[model samples]
Target: MQLITAHVMSKHLSLSSFSFRAPQDSPEKAIPSRKLPFQTFLSFNPKKPLSLKTHLPIMQISKTLFVFCLISCLSMTSSQEQGATAYEMLEKFNFPRGILPQGVRSYVLNTDGSFEVYLDGECKFGVEGGYSLSYGRKITGKVSFGSLRNLKGVSVKVLFVWMGITEVSTGNGELDFYVGPLSASFPLSNFLDCPQCGCGFNCKDIVSDS
Candidate 1:
């Protein structure tokens, strides 16, 4: 009975040792679970709401800049159109008159911007006008002229007129008119009207015969 008991006790101790060693030597038991990084966890957290307050100001500034650029472009286009129109009118009317007629005259621009022209002592035309420069400078005036008269019987009269400006420069500021015999081959400056010149005589001979 004692021998049987000793054999059973030794067998029980051996099985206990084997169970302890099996866990320490196993590859699956040695492997550890991978843990996620803190940064990665924050980025993927679906329950957290992201605040975009810092970006709002930048977006607003960009929008403001876009609007400013658009306004500047529109202003430039309008100024160019006005300048073109003014230049066209000058070329069509003023430049062709190489010399002003004896009776054709321009009124001196005044502080109150009013002036008059007379033809044969008669009131003819007048104008009241105002102008501004691109830089916001202002010029205002009115001009009136009388009937234009010559020995040739051609006469013209002007009515009241006014002009406004956005800007002024030396190159853009003159008014001119022409008057002479239409049939004469020579420029009117080459001949002078005589004291007795009348509508019945040739303009060329009237000056020489006098």
Candidate 2:
């Protein structure tokens, strides 16, 4: 009986020792910390002045900002060169683009203030009077904001007489039309309405064939 009791006591002590022992660490968790030269220097000299190591990040940031701004400016210039149209160019010169009727096929503007405007073909339509107005296939003139000179290829009929309108000048909110030595003044507001190729001031195709 004594031998059996000793055997049972030894078994209980061995089981308790096995269960209470600390768990073994994994290979990754047991890895030892490695201190690099720079890390060791920083840890030893915390109050030391920052060297190029600290300023390198700031320099890189500055370089990045400069590149970004340069790219933005280049993109803006590219868009302006490609996006601006002929009508928008008219606005740039401070003139309303409506002065030219619709169906303008093309135009050439010179640096010396001269310009040539082209229509698809000859355009004619009746105006306020029973008389008719006609535009040739091409018109050439010197153009400034609110003014056109040496005009050609446009004509109007008045009182059964067809007169060539040679020049147009603007001032005091009025446009002066020159037909030979005679001139007529009309409100500048009249040009706000863009004319059509075959309908003159009418855009809704209301002009009758009669």
- State, as a TM-score between 0 and 1, how close model 2 is to the true structure: 0.53
Task: Return model 2's CA RMSD, one decimal.
Answer: 25.6
- The TM-scores, one per candidate, come to 0.21, 0.53
Off by over 4 Å in 2: 1-86, 129-131, 205-210
For each candidate, what is the lDDT?
0.29, 0.64
**In candidate 2, what are the lDDT values of residues 1-210, reduced to their tens digit?**
011111113433332222111235533343233333432333333234434354554567778777777765544332124566556766666555656667777776665567777888888876553657778889888778767889898888888888888988778877677899988776767666667777777656574533
Tell me, by lDDT, which candidate is best.
2
- C-alpha lDDT (0 to 100) for residue 93 of candidate 1: 30
What tens digits encode model 1's per-residue C-alpha lDDT throughout 1-210? Answer: 011111113443332222112245456443333333332433432234533354555567778777777765544332123444322322333232221222322222222223232223212121112211110111122322311222122233222322222121112234322323221122323222211112221444556888
